[model samples]
Target: MMTCLCDAFFDDVARATHEVLESLGIEVIVPESQTCCGQPAFNGGDWASARQVIRHTLNVFQGDCPIIVPSGSCAAMSFHGALLAHEKETDLPQVQAFGARTWEICDFLRNGLGIESWEGRLDARVAIHSSCHSRGTGTPEAIRTLVGSIAGVTLLDFTQPEQCCGFGGTFSVTFPHISGSMGRLKIDSVRATHPDLLVSGDMSCLMHLNGLAEKQGSPLPVKHAIQVLRDARVTPVTVQ
Candidate 1:
């Protein structure tokens, strides 16, 4: 199947996602015009702007291939945001069609392809910081299942594992104080683990928590789960 990568451009999430697909030998193409699923606008209660944002995404991904989105947040937007975002009933068919082709990257790899386990090695301990969407969508479980398949990677369950990092797109901007407090709590929990890395499917969450981690002078690095998976697949060649 030809896969069109829905690169959400949230830090290096897209890059890591693409590498993971290629590592699995999946044929993936990124639609250059793709941008935000209008999540910030949608979550901010501006459906009008969201309609515009989603329409562009729909138009760019008009094809039969599976649209693999790296960000669970963007995947959530594509699956539900477009279908209900528009004011016009006529838009439903087109929006719904686009959603039908969209899949979160991890979901696509695990369920779509029936990949129960992976073969690779990574000695570092890690924590998964699930996006708020994951708590409801079961994305964290999907991620955990995949991460556990790796040979040497240790998955840590930090405190309040299901809590939100407080980066609700525009919600963080509209309500900074509450957002910061929630972010610190999240970072604190992850820091307490002293893991080498904190990982998640949403770059938005990583960007938020990573910024706070840096401020607190914590040494752990934040990354998309895909990066960890991608790196695991590589068998390092010793010096000949």
Candidate 2:
């Protein structure tokens, strides 16, 4: 099942995420019963609330099938929260099983399916923004390799590619000014290469960076890596 975070609701960054999966002949299902992975609660020192949310999530996503998440942050939350929030060893086994089956969307596509060639094409230059969780999970490398598979996309390089965009969930809210400043810096670094679009595994960083660009009256288009891979602009397949 695919875990589409609420963050994708606004601009629908993941509008074509499922379509891309299905295009590859993979079955995709997202349980409407699912909610937040409790990353916020866990990060804010509320283990009890986090544990409750995770238990509900586990119940909703019960299956041996892998739980695929679009956001690296949410993916990390479920994988780590399972172990961190559980107090008893009895609960540990179940949560651990859930974590073992969880796969970040990019990881699932690039590694899980062993996708070599892509029918979708793009002619734009792209830059990658690394999320903290994506870095920890080594998803950025896989993402780069996948982007390279595209026909006409040129992934650009600039200084400090691994730097955080400063949208550390609650950290951004509690420290808005600092967060905004860091975002500006991150965008500045991105703009240094003057790419046509920026892509990342997480929407939070994209939102933060894109919001800052808009505020500064700069035009930095941001996209989730999943959306780019979907390549919805590809010519439609004509049927007989």
Candidate 3:
């Protein structure tokens, strides 16, 4: 089972991930019954809606195969925080069990499945933004390890690499000015790295940073980490 805020983001990520896994001869079963992990509702402080989403998600993926999510925010919600929020609910036991089996996709690849190499090469210096939700879920190291596996790639350690890009979904809507300021700070850090590309696990954060960079005419391009790994066969074009 995998979950995200919307179907489009999830489908894109799932497509990329499925390509990678199939290339590596690892088969994955994507349950069509899965829905949003309810992080939006949870983050928005709507506990009841969050619980409802969680309950439906658990019911859908209760089998032996582990739940793998592409979004760190969604994974963290189901893996660590959601159970605590609905602890008093009668379905607490089921929620807790589901949480235990949830794994971020990178973590599942690098740790659970023991994937140590990729088939593509970008041959360029890159900087990685460790999304806050990914770090909170303890999967940032997994991302780094997976990125490191690509040949001809250098993962530079930029300043404030782990800072939030301030695109917390609805948080950006509620506090646009603050969000813009925070995004600018992240963009500055990425610029300082002089990377050919910027990569992160979360699409929302990447989209936010990419928009800011485009607005300022920054040369660096943004990509999801999975895209980087899956496209390792082709050299990335240098930004002018």
Cα RMSDs, all models: 3.7, 3.7, 2.3
The candidate, 1 or 2, that scores higher on lDDT is: 2
- Which segments of candidate 2 are over 4 A away from where they belong? 1-11, 87-89, 236-240
lDDT of the structure predicted as candidate 3? 0.77
Q: Report the lDDT tens digits of candidate 2 across residue range 84-180.
A: 7785657888898898888877788877888655656787788888789876685777678786677777889978876779888889999999998
Query: What local lDDT does model 2 show for residue 78?
Result: 73
Instruction: Give candidate 3's error at residue 54 in angstroms.
Output: 0.9
Candidate 1 lDDT over 95-127, as tens digits, reads: 888778877778788888778887777777878
True-vs-predicted CA distance for residue 92, candidate 1, Å: 0.6
Best by lDDT: 3
lDDT of 3 by residue, 1-240 (tens): 445543655466677777777776777887788778878888889988888888888888877677777767777888767887787888888888888898877888888888766655677788888888776555788788888777778888888766789899899989999999999998887788788888887778887888777888864587778877777744443333
TM-score for predicted model 1 compared with the true structure: 0.89
Which pairs clash inside model 2? none
What TM-score should be assigned to candidate 3?
0.90
Candidate 2: residue 130 lDDT (0-100): 73
Give the whole-model CA lDDT for all candidates, comma-separated. Answer: 0.75, 0.76, 0.77
Q: After superposition, how far is residue 65 of candidate 1 from its true place, in Å?
A: 0.7
The positional error of residue 72 in candidate 1, measured at the CA in angstroms, is 0.6
